[model samples]
Target: MQDVPRIIKAASLRHLTLGLAALLVLAITLALPAGPAAADPGDVEAASRGVVRVVIIGEEGDQPVPISHGTGFAVSPTRIVTNAHVVSEATQDDTLRIGIVPPEGKGGAFARVIAISPRNDLALLEIAKGALRLPPLALAGGNGANLGEVAAVGYPMNVDLAQGLDMADIFSAQPPVKSRGFLSGERPSRQFDTILHTAPIARGNSGGPLLDPCGRVIGVNSFSADSSGGDGEFYFAVSLRELLPFLRSNGVEPTTNTLPCRSIDELNAEERQRLEAEQSQARERMAQRSEEMREVRDKARLTAQMQVLAARENRMALALIALIAAIGAGYAASVWRGDAARTTQARLAAAASAAALVIAGLLWITRPGLAEIEDRVAAALAEAEGGPAPEPTSPSTAAEGDLICTLVPDRSRVTAARTDDVALEWSADGCVNGRTQYGLGKGGEWIRVFAAQEDSAVAVNTYDPATRTLRTDRYLLGAEALAEAREARAAYTPPSCGVSDAARTLGEQQSALIAKLPDRPNERLVYSCTAKAAAR
Candidate 1:
């Protein structure tokens, strides 16, 4: 009985010991791995759009029941990628049906199994033409970097059970769950290439996309280990090495992105640096112009003063010479008073001297003043440039005519969009492509805002003519937000081109709506534009 107290103490400390070990493990996992930045909410939201639920339906006594459920993601507009086991029963039995529940909307869609690789445990299903359309997730060019951050997006069955959702609810569209963790390593499975990650996933999460911080598809979540052996749960995803060939063999072209993953904070910081550099350059330019103007003014003043002084000295000398000539002529006339021809010549000389004296007085009275120095400087500077100095104008006002705009990747953050150059036709009257009218925004930018009905995306496009920069920001909204945006769009009427006041009013209205949007956009594209030369 003496060891009873010691046994009790050990039992009590068991829970504490386990708890401390768990904490230590968590701290190590979080602190040790040098991974990409954490996932952004906007990026996750955008990536989740393509994630769907793959439900297997079986009919029992004329009643349809969901026999199995798993997750899948769009690889193309009409093709979905999922695990072979998810639809294996349906493939074996023709009567079994496969249903796809999108991330949004009212009802589910039916799809046909196009390709199934049992060895790789992968399958491709094609949705009916024009039945369902979802933005395909962009696959990462490589499997993934070790210890990098990753997110798994999918519809887990445990969640449905926890929410107590019925079969009908399962068919209805709903958003998927996102679990974030770090990539452990590349551990190829016995059957196929696989990437090992720590992103939590359940049975129903199979075939979902494992994404990077930038919302790029790094791998396809397929399965998880049965036991972690004291570590946290680890999951495995099908690597792109296997997925690429599988997709190509099926003739499905997947969108792949090779750009490095960057967080919004980094992008914002870079933008701030760029703006500061521009401001510094602008200040330098202003200082240089001020110096040039000072030099020009000083030079003009000196030249004008020298010219005036020379003119004055010449006038005084001419006046003195004329007086002396007049005195000589008077003396000649007196001496030659009796000679008529000499007297007439002397009289003519005196008249000419008197006229010269009047001209000198007028010249001295009409000499230029100090104010004329500024005028001379302006004229000199204008002459040097071959025209009057141009007044500074807003960039938006100067961006007109046909322009070829190339992507400024350093100044932009692109998640799922293309980097192709854009051709724009702009008019000085705020017309785009000669049809769509753009409103003048508060920042002196020409802006156009629109929300697509086909997708839950709102886009704001802005153009700064001064910088010749065009920017497009896309917001992937949820159901409620999309509804609100649609309502806002319905209430507003776009103004016609050339109506500055109306366009400004519309811009203000749109700006108010924009203010209500999330701080960061899902995708941002910036293009530097140049005018297209006229065809000869």
Candidate 2:
């Protein structure tokens, strides 16, 4: 029996302990906040388009042979960045030529060394005129934090050696290899500052970009730490401290992204949540409005009934008074039969009594019917406001001319898109800036599609006059698809801004071009617009 009590106590204690643990777990779960959203994988691929292979070619007899090769990235459509050592031979020897191989394409273009700094090991090369244009990569304004995620994008020599590419294959265009790791720390050299990261790099990765999760350039890959120390290998990149000033002094202004990095999935989730909350609030407002309307209707019905009942009672009372007057007047006429002057007064009273009786009959017949309750209720509500009721209005559908549109960041998902105010001149017939005619899309918004020969992007722009909003979606294409888009653009001759018929035809052509585009764009920018005066 003693053992039984002890066991029971032990069981009770165990249960109490489990209950406390459950409560503690619940509290802790509630206390802990959500972690940051994950970075989009597409960011790396999109940024890799800017990475190129810098090949140093030398003349061997009548044929051009590659002497050395290194990696570089586009700072502008025409300018490229690489290590000074990669192109030093070309700068010294006129026979050695510099060839720029893009991530995608059949062949490479030639470039000339415009700037070189041996101390910083950074060199700038300008692509030849009429060469293909590469999209520029944005540079981060802030110094990246230690242990943050970083990615090295470049064309390493090991890949070429592993694939056993010949001289002809080496000079051809191919995508760069990507290595992802965490940033170690900032290791500033005696001459210049550098970023230490764990992302692996090889010989040919000399001047490639060290990118943040958002694909912004944080540094330029320079060299790697010696692995002979038994410690894990770490690579060093020329940090933005040296890279930014070098580019700025050379009159290069690449796009800079300062906003916090967020993935499309996270943006979409937040947008869904916002829409749900807005819908919930709308439902609540509708319920509240219904309650208010019901109250008004009840008050109006009660007021109308009371007024009708009061009128009916007044008519009955007046009828009784008229009947009494008629009886009194008849008695007066009989009593005044002997006197001529009094008889005339009695006859006049009798005539007035007949008129009163006729009015009473008309009043009794014309009392409001039961069917008039709703009509009277409506009239009473309208009359209470001192005028007739007004109809409901909707959003404006008129043309908005000479307007300035500002970016709405919260409602937008931007990667490499610019965050500047857009200027627009709109017409009622979907003409923009008095030169370009836009087609009316299925969604009732004005749309324009553009695909240029030199650029590797297809742009679709849409504007909603009702919401006074503008949106631009850019689809970055590879070499093959871009060629097709260029062909389509060449075939379609856009009409000038004029009649609706021309606008309709333009829309058909735009739709045809759109059909040839990819299903989705890599970046989308949304802007809310207002009149120019309001913007000022």
Candidate 3:
């Protein structure tokens, strides 16, 4: 029994020792302070306390709409920072409200806008007096926090749940919305000055602070993932450090200090009127410049049309002169043939020939004018119809003419139903009726026959003449042959035989024909027939 009491005492001592050790540990932990336990590494609560939610409502069409909802943070005790787009819908007349929620039991507070920077999409708001006393977040320094470690905080989609206090409401009716991601890289140069990589942000997250691990404001969440099917979970933010200078320039200080109260009604009316006048002036100047540009374009179109008309008129005058000269030459030739007195006839013939020469000279001069007029008219018509003008084809480039000839029995003729591929043969000198050595036939053969003269010619159709009937070995010439034959027949007579006027007209016609043909590898002399040969 005595040993039991001793054992109890021993057990009590052991309990006391254990208690002392535990008390010592407790004292040390208490002495260490509450900050380290509560704060994340490299994070300070003072930097995150100012973060807030921004809400905007304005008139869209006929109804009041929730134009925007985004995040913002207090940089000073009275001033908050957010994206300009967030409050853009709120006009000077519309109500611009901001909600500031702090951690713990600190209830939400409201604020009004002080100034907005539209170019950078940022705004500064002044918290109303008697509002919640919120801690301010510090803007990170120029060495801007390293790229890979940043945290974004905003009400996000769970804002509705945060608005009303019901744990059941948050769990049952609302989705649990908490997302986190790391920064991927530093933004490229100022073209895209500040960009951050985090889990894709939601519509409500723009203007939210992208906090560094230390809880310092590094960037402001801006855009979310693009719909381009790339890595869609990426988001971007504007660096807070870069935005500080801009805010200061606009008369807002960046320190965590609040200003005394002043309501919107306190501002003088004169300043408001001046701002409105300046905006109106800027708009008027833009409208005037746009009108001037339109006038200049109209003038250029009119000038082009006038140039085309002038060229057409010049060609028409030449063709008319050629036609009149041809008629005069024919009349002079008939007068000379009717005079029969030997001596008087010779004199009359000479006078008639001189008249003809004058007519021919006129015709020669006008022939080119006539053809040019025709071409110009065709071109103008094409232009008016919006069709491409036909290019003048040189004789050398002319499509092969149709073959025309008398095929002896047992001989062949070539025919082309379509003009493109068939070949035409005539005298080597290009005279249509001159003798031909051989002719192209319809079935793609060459037919040869004896001729009265080496220059005697014949024509035959070279490919398909018609669908069912093949005109192989048959000679038939169409319009192409008739034109060539007429020109050749005219060339056979000497220019000196008729009245001078007639000779002149004929010479002009020949010159015009030569001009129409393309240059060839071989030169050919014009044909001539003596007066005796025609009489015989």
Candidate 4:
């Protein structure tokens, strides 16, 4: 019994603490001043995602070792741009291999030097687009890095030197070293378009991108003219005027964003300010409505008091007059009692006086009170819609943000299918003449996506390896829907068998629950795909 009381006391204390904490948080939230706030976007970090460390592998003393290396950035999903010299060593012989160290992972993917512009020291490298899909670096326009503005971006070199690292450390992982400086001037260049900037870089930084404040690549770092010994102070980069032409000629089209980049921090601050201002405005409106209600309520109360007081005074005055009349009638009745006609007249007068007194008494008792008027006023205010009700929060139909995907072939699940289902028509360059492939691993199961020969229909196959069960669902959609579904996610609720309603794709069972789609495959075709790359 004692322990029970102690436990109850402790629980009460905990609840009190929780209530206080919640109130404190609410107060803080309300105290924030209305100001500018916006969404924060990490553009610098996003740009760096496309930047990769290029390594040219060659023989050193008969053993294959890293020959030279530079930086390269993705202009498209499959294409990368770097300095011509970066892939020059690989061009000499088939033995030289070029590999890329992407920003995220430990290992790398191999790239083939696709195009070269020796005149401008720029080259484009092609990679297996299926292996990696990084956000392309947005290119700046003709009005590139401005004078006296800060230039900053990822670079290599000067790091190992500063760290006192030896040659063997070259193969080790190297993250991009960020450096910033002013754009001194554009050198008087006749060879090709160039930008002269004081952005700090090193020997291996030959092909690294020079970025503006919003993380847009304004120029490609090329060469440095030495005036003071060792490393130079004057560094020049290939400007967009020259670089854009090279990209166009090489069939490399990079995406560009025209809106000036805004710092994420500034955006977030702006958003917070806007939210606070909205809350403050709502509070002020409520306060104004309350003040108006108070004024109306006070006026009604005064009016009700005056009306009731007048009714009470009238009732009292009528009752006194009635009383005087009754007394006069009684005296007259006594005087007139001597004669029959006078007595009859006296009786009628007495009866009339009695009726008047009764009426006055009833009026006094039933008169409306001040409290009743106030109650009516309060009820009327309650019934009135004080102000416009706040809009209800909208319910989301689909998941927010983007359902970004890296489409690739289901290598593991392909083995489970019959050989006839998926003919191995993969070429050396990872393309098939008549088929397309895309799939994703989900819930420890493989979901294969297939496109028909005419590209008129698309199908999804979910396979259960453990049970060797294959479930195929097909849909015939317009080109836009098909293309959108491939790059993004499209899902529907799966049919349930004594289960909860959850969203899913094709499964073993198909019934009334599943939508009846049109123009599908004849028999689902036991869904499988040829793992061949498609050129986007």
Candidate 5:
């Protein structure tokens, strides 16, 4: 009762204790890891791959000169996005040329402005046909760029930033610089929706990409706040809301990935986890299937054994009955001898006994055994488990006695023989042609492999599902064709060899090589082998 006042005083301080607790929580949250320090390095590298240095090459009297420069990135195979101001000279005058220097490569190609929006300060440039194709950067999803950890990827301040480098170094093969900062805010109703951030940029940094923590292009670096060399001043970018529409209007569709980006180390860890999960699932399924097969095989084997046992018992019973009859007949023959008729009856009874003994001996010799039944059950079980042969990898893979090769048939591989008239498929079992033995096995994308050859030549063919194109690369052997391929040669379908003049010309190109091979029977390409066809 005396302490009632003390207790009331303590109650009055309860609000103050709660306020302190709330302050403590705020402090903890602020102490958490922030910005670029927490972002993924792998994602930053991926985004930088699409960034390029834009050099506006202009004429100074007679000699060509690299005029003003800025940064840009690929949005499509042939289209680039940059600030309209960066390429203003080119857009205004046709003679002022635009050249794109990729982050990783030396040679660059000239470009022409395909679309421009002076109001939005955005411009689209198209590289000439057959130039180096850079990996296109995809815009963020419908949610667009928001306040989070961001990366600014581009080449900033030319000779000033990088010490002891001339203009040539600026335009050479070098990856863009990366800066990490927090995307803090946005301008609600500005021309060309703008995003505000603290990522550092300079004169040549304009038109670079502003990527989210997940490596998505959320915005493009447009301009910075009037810093007057202030350290804490903000920078701004053109958000995806305006960028997406601008690209679509100009007939370009950039790639997009909504998946969250992780550091390379983290990504590898996740991949290992996924593979382990799938392997475990596959093992479980195989075990279950094996158990089911065992049960079915056991039941069938048991039924067969029982039938055999029953058959043996039936033969024994018949043999026993015959023996008893034969014994009785033989005894009757021994005891009976009264007249000439009686003697004849006795002889017949003896003959009947001999015949019965012969029949019993044959039955014993032909009895069913357990070993034979076991062999049959094993064979049936093996058949249930995917037969005895290994599955092939590609349509054209083979291994012969002394050689092994994996061949892919392009229509160009065929000359005088047209595709419609000839079949170029491989057999399921495998085949052999000349010194080369053809075999198909599961694994690898190699088109040509010569295991015994001294020349370490190999051909690799990669296919893109999006464009439905196949690109082939031959290592030492195709060096002569490299120039032609670099110029233009991804898809290779030969002209029809339907007794045409063009076919005759093309055959000459392949004839010299084809003539060198040693001829062998069944040397033709085999896609499938039918039992009926084989029999013929």
Candidate 6:
């Protein structure tokens, strides 16, 4: 391992520990070797020959960006396998470019994507015919490759002479840079269908093959262990057996080959500087937002304090007023003497006391207003903090109105007849629409009585209990048209029950009569009705 920064090294160690623990448990339970077996230098070198560096190029928001870089191995003389996400956005004709720099500094051939499987993030590319000397690595068998086997492979980010070479254009690419790590664990059954282990891979290392000690390909180096940074410390790979099915599905067979090895150092100084700048800017922006939030919170606290002070002042004022009134009453009672003088003084004292009591009572009742003030302050604070307000009761309307009718029982029955409907009479004020009305149903579901008009009074048809019918000398409007009828009646005055008092009395009587109606499911019965005009 090359000397790297402590932070990077620490992060690498942490990842190694975690990866090894998971790998060890999986190996022991599955009866695989706990560590990767060491591979021969020649065999490792041979396997590295097929490893190829993968470069992805595409347009990002009008500018061409090299969005992804990874490694791949030639499965056949003409076919290379790489990670699916590497060339996802590229079209078939978008230039499936591949490059290989031999150990002796020779260029290799380019290729194009033939098939891709994003579900597993694997893609197969087709190179030009008869381009390379190396064959694809041989895939290991079932019962799978041994765990802890030494896997040697090179990745794009690994330090190598190829770093100086125009990697952008290389044919017989140098063998993949080599890194050795033991198979940490078996791959999950659901995804790869082959075993996996912890090996150090990097960003530029993806799609590289994971080769066993004997130069047999067991897995493809697809992902890395360093999730935080581009340090080629620990790695993950897609198993070769898993790759085979996908390759076979697309009608291609992987071949065995030994490629040359190249060493590439990790990120250069310029890349490190750029990454640091970005991270610093992000931290500054976060700090600024935090300060803004603190300021807003301070403003809310100040507002709440002001409201609390005001409420305290109001409470003090009320208390002082009560105290003064009590002192005045005592002084008045003590100074007066004689019958008339004493009586007058007593009355004055009593009046003062009564007034004070009334004031105190008002203050006590309105103490909730102070509480409400606090609540309002709290609500404002809550709103500042982005919370919902409490629900409040409906407000009352102060419009003047008149009662339209009154229903009275016959002299004998205090409780109005359950079956009988009292007559409805209405009186209208002189206004365009000023008639008081009363509904006679038990639950206040009103039965229309009289229309609003200028009339003094109008009688509804008599309700007959036997037929359950109302007989009227005059036509009464239906409930739907009651509003218009009431407007019209406001202008007319009927002689008998036109007065406001008479209407109110009649409305009360009708309400009483309706209250006596027998309770029945879904039954609505009207006992009495009245209409009166609005108050002046």
Model 2 stretches with alpha carbons more than 4 Å out: 1-39, 323-354, 379-401, 426-431, 434-446, 453-455, 489-512
Cα RMSD, each candidate = 8.2, 15.0, 38.6, 23.8, 17.3, 35.4
Q: For model 1, how does the per-residue alpha-carbon lDDT over 1-536 read when each residue is reduced to its tens digit?
A: 34423322321101112244444545766777487678886787888888999988777789877667788999987899998878877888897889999988785789999999977878999998788877788898777855788999998767877999865577788899999988877756678887777788876788899998888888888877644346456677888888999999999988887766776678789999999999999999999988987887788778877775676677667666766665665566566667776777767766765665566566555655556666777787777556886898655567668999888878788788778888888877678887788887887778998886865578899988777788998887776787788788877788776665766777877876787778888878889888888411
| Candidate 3 lDDT score relative to the true structure | 0.45
What would you estimate as the lDDT of candidate 5? 0.58
Best by TM-score: 1
- Give each model's clash number: 3, 0, 34, 11, 13, 91
Candidate 2 overall lDDT versus native: 0.77
User: Arrange candidates by TM-score, highest first: which order?
Assistant: 1, 2, 5, 4, 6, 3
Q: Give the Cα RMSD of candidate 6.
A: 35.4
Per-residue lDDT of 1-536 in model 6, one digit per residue for the tens? Answer: 12223212221211233345454454464675354335655556545556666655444466433334566776665578877766654554353333443333355555678898867768888876666443455665433444556564655543533466432333334446777766655655445543445555554666677776656677766654443433224456676556878899999855432321111111124336756897899899889867876676677557766766676668668966886896788667656634574888777886787788677667655553435545665565566656876575321111122322232222111100123433332222211123434333343222334422422122332332221223222222222233344554454443332454543344444543233322211111223322233311
Q: lDDT for every model?
A: 0.78, 0.77, 0.45, 0.56, 0.58, 0.50
- The number of the candidate with the highest lDDT is 1
Candidate number with the higher lDDT (5 or 6): 5
Better of 1 and 2 by TM-score: 1
> Pairing residues by index, what is the TM-score of model 3?
0.34
Best to worst by lDDT, what's the order?
Answer: 1, 2, 5, 4, 6, 3
* Candidate 5 structure quality by residue, lDDT tens digits, 1-536: 34423422321101112244334433543565553435555556655766888877767688666666778998876788998877876777777788898876467888888998867778899999998676566676643434468888887764334576655465676778889887765664345687767787776777899887656788888776554432245677888878888998888877664433444444346648867998999999999998989896997699768877877777777777777777887787786655566998888888887777777766666667667577667767777776866765534333112222222231122111112222122222222222212222123221222211322122333322222223333232222232333222222233332323432343343333323322311011212222233324
lDDT of 1: 0.78
The CA lDDT at 48 in model 3 is 42
Worst 10 residues of 5 by lDDT: 410-419
lDDT score of residue 280 within candidate 2? 100
Model 6 global lDDT (CA atoms, 0 to 1): 0.50
Shift of residue 404 alpha carbon in model 2, Å: 2.1
